[model samples]
Every structure is written in C-alpha cells, then in structure tokens.
Target: MIQLTVNGKPRKADVDPDTPLLWALRDSLLLTGTKYSCGSGLCGACTVHVDGQPVRSCITPVSAVAGKKVTTIEAVDGSRVGKAVQEAWRKLDVVQCGYCQSGQIMSAVGLLSKNRRPSDADIDAAMAGNLCRCATYVRIRAAIHEAAKALA
Candidate 1:
C-alpha cells in the first residue's frame, strides 16, 4: 500500500509501485481534476503540487510520493491564492475550449503562490509548459497578473 496525503486528506492505495500518480489519483482516489494530456510529462496538463511544488503527476510514480502531500485543482479554492486565481480566471474569461484550463489554472496558481507579483517574463517562463490550443495565452497572463494584484 502506498501512503500519501491528497488534498489535505491522508489515504492509502493498493497498487503497483510503478503506477503513475495520475492513475492513482484518477482511478484509485477519484480525483480527476489533474488532466492527462502528455503522458511523458512534456505538457503541464498533469501538474499537481507535491509538497507545494508543482510536479507532473503523469511521470511521477505513486511510490515516489509516499507520505508526501499532494494537492490537486479540486482543493485549490481552499487557499487564498487559489481562490484569487479562480476569480481572476472567471473575471477575465480565460477559457476557450476549456479542455486545458484546469491545468492552466493549476500552473497559474503554482506560479502566483511563489511570486505574488510576477512580471510578463516571469509569467511566460512559469506558464510556458502549459499549452492551450485555443491560444488564450494573453488572457491567461492577464488573469495571473490580476490574481497577483488581488492577493496583494
């Protein structure tokens, strides 16, 4: 059994040691907010916070996170920064097709948690890995800046 804390709740899962955290989350734990776009970890769709640092869950094994804290988009609104990010996303209307918005928001929240006032370059660098086929980069950047202001 692999032990871990997900969205602030302690849990255990009986699965292969090599099972990707994404599967453990989506299948075992039933937390599907974390997407599975690029299984190789190239895309940021599977981003989740492991001990408050954004990590690609698709490439992370369940055994690797034993006894660690895992935070998903489901619990993001529980924090001030996350709520601000969600509000900013809504006010800015940053979603187009919305397939990748969760991941985008996850990345945005991760960036804002560390840097409250991120510059254009900072936002770009932080969000570079999260691809939005709808091409909503402008709105995403604006929402990140807006969330930073709200958190300030």
Candidate 2:
C-alpha cells in the first residue's frame, strides 16, 4: 500500500505504486474533479495542486506524491480564491459543455493565487495546456480577471 494526502485527508491505496494519481483520485478516492485528458501530460485537464503548486496529475504517479498534500478541484473550490473563481465563472457563464471546466477552474485558481493580477498573456501561459472543446476562452479569461479583482 502507498500512502498519500489528498485534500487534507490521509489515505492509502493498495494499487500499483506507479498508478497515475489521476486514476487513484478518481477510481480509488472518488474525487473526480481532476479530469483525465491527454494522459501524456500535454493536457492540463488533470491539474491539481501538490503542496500548493499546480501539477498535471495524469502523468504523475501516486508514489511521486508519497507525503505531499494533493488539492483537487473539489477541495480547492472552498477556498477564498477558489470561491472567487467559481463565483466568477458563474457570473460570466464561463462553462460550455462542462466537461473541461473543472480543470479550467483548477488551473485558473492556481494562476490567480500566485498573481492576483495577470495580463492576457499571463492567463494564456497559465492556461496553455487546458483545452476546452466548447471554446469558452473569452469567458474563461473574463472570469479569471474577475476572480483576480475579487481576490484583490
């Protein structure tokens, strides 16, 4: 069994040490907010914060986070910045199709926490890997900016 901390809770899984955290989170822990897209790490759909730093969980092994705190979208949405992001998303109606919004919100929260004010290029860089099929880029950008102002 391998041990890891997720969303402030400690848990263990009796799976392969090399199992991707994305699987462990969705399958084992039942925390499905972090998505699986482009499992090779090119996609940010599986973004989560490990020790407060956003990481692509699709390519990250559970063992790699042996003692680290993993913050998924579920837990993150309850925070100050996170709540702002969620509220902004709703206010701007940033989601379309809804499949990738979780990941998008996760990435946005990660970016806004570090930089309360981000330019369009900064938002692009922070959200570069997350692909949205419905093309809500304009709304996503607007939500992020609104969330930043809310945080500030």
Candidate 3:
C-alpha cells in the first residue's frame, strides 16, 4: 500500500510502486482533475502540487510522492492563493476548451504561491510546460497577473 496525503486527506492506494500517480489519483482515489496528456510529462496537463511544488502526475510514480502532500484542482479553492487564482481565471474567462484549464490553473497557483509578483518572463517560464492548444495564452497571463494583484 502506498500512503500519501491528498487534498488534506490521508489516503492509501493499493498499487504497484511504479504505477503512475495519475492512475492512482484518477482510478484509485477518483480525483480526475489532474489530466492525462502526453503521458511522458512533455505536457503539463497532469500537473499537481506535490509538497507545494508543481509536478507532472502522468509520469510520476505513486511511490515517489509517498508520505507527501498532493493537491489537485478539486481542492485548489481551499487555499488563499488558489482561491485568488481561480477567481482571476473566472473573472478573466481564461478557459478556452476547458480540458487543459485545470492543469493550467494548477500550474498558475503553484507559480503564484511561491512568487507573489511574477513578470511576463517569469509567467512564461513557469507556464512553459503547460500547453493550451486553443492558444489562450493572453488570458492566462492576464489572469496570473490579476491573481498576483489580488493576493497582494
């Protein structure tokens, strides 16, 4: 059994140690907000916060995060920074297709949690791995800036 804290809840997944965390989350834990795209971690669709840092769940082994805290989009609004990011995303209409928004928001929250004031270059670098096929980069950047301001 692999044990971990998920969204503030203690949970256990009875899976192989090498099983990807995405499957453990989506299949065992039933938290599907962390998406699966480009399963090799090239894309950030599977982004989730492990120990307060963003990680790609699709390529991460469940055992790798053992005994650590894993936060997903489902519980994002529970935090001050997360709430601000979500609000900014809503106010700015950052969702285009909506498939990748959860991961995008996860990455944004991760970025804002550490750096309260991120410039365009910082935002780009932080969000470089996350891909939005719909190309909503403008709104995403705007929402990040707005969230930073809100959290200030």
Candidate 4:
C-alpha cells in the first residue's frame, strides 16, 4: 500500500511500487485533471506538485511519493497563488484546444508560487518543458504577469 496526501487529504492506494504516480492518481484516485500527454515525461501534461515542487507524474513512481503531499490541478484553486493564476488564465482566455491548459496552469502556478514577480526569461525557463501545440505562449506569459500583479 502506498500512502500519501493528495489535495490535503490522506489517501492510500493498493498498487505496485513501480506504478507511475499518473496512473495512481487517474486510475486509483480518480484525479483525471492531470492529463497524460507524452507519457515519457518530456511534456509537462502530467505535471503535479509533490511537496509544492512541480513534478511530472508520468515518470514519478507512486512509492517515491509516500508520506509526501501531492497537489493536482483539481485543488489548485484552494490556494491564493493558484487561484490568481487560474483567474488570470480565465480572464485572458488562455485556453486554445484546452487539452494542455491543465498542465500549463499547473506549471504557471508552480512558477508563481516561488517567484512572485517572474521576468519573461524566468517564465520561459520555468515553462519551457510544457509544450502547447496551439502556440499560446504569448498569452500564457501575459497571464503569468497578470497573476503576479494580482498577487501583489
């Protein structure tokens, strides 16, 4: 049994230690907001916060997260930074196809949580791994800045 805290709730899953956290979250825990794109962890679609640090769930083993806190897109709005980022996304209409927005939001929330005011280069470096096929990079960057301003 793998034990962890997800979205501030303690949970246990009866899965193999080698099972990827993405499967544990989607299949076992029913947290499907974390998308599965590029299962090899190259793409940031499977991004989630493990102890407040953004991590690609696709490559993370469930066992590795034992006794740690995991935060998903579903619970992002619970926090001030996350709510600000999400509001910025909605106000700016950042979603194109919508498939990648969850991951993008997750990455953006992670970036803003650490750096209250991130420069363009900081946003680029932080979000570099998250690919948006719709090419919404400009809007994403703008939304990040907006969220930062809102937080300040």
For each of the candidates, the C-alpha root-mean-square deviation to the true structure, in angstroms, is 0.8, 0.9, 0.6, 0.6
Structure candidate 4, residue pairs in collision: none
Clashing pairs in 1: none
Better of 1 and 3 by TM-score: 3
Whole-model lDDT values for every prediction: 0.92, 0.90, 0.94, 0.95
What is the C-alpha local distance difference test score of candidate 3?
0.94
Q: Rank the candidates by TM-score, best first.
A: 4, 3, 1, 2
Q: Assess the local accuracy of residue 139 in candidate 4 as a C-alpha lDDT between 0 and 100.
A: 97
Could you tell me the lDDT of residue 70 within candidate 4?
A: 98
The whole-model C-alpha lDDT of candidate 2 against the native structure comes to: 0.90
Give the per-residue lDDT of model 1 (tens digit) for 1-152. 88999999998887898999999999999998899997998888899989988889999999999989999999999999999999999999999898788888888988999999999999999998898888999999999999999999
Q: Could you estimate the TM-score for every candidate?
A: 0.97, 0.96, 0.98, 0.98
Worst lDDT 10-window in candidate 4: 98-107
Residues forming the 10-long window of minimal summed lDDT in candidate 3: 94-103
Off by more than 4 A, model 3: none
Candidate 2 lDDT trough over 10 residues, lowest sum = 35-44
Instruction: Write down the TM-score for model 1.
Output: 0.97
- Return the lDDT, model 3, position 78: 99
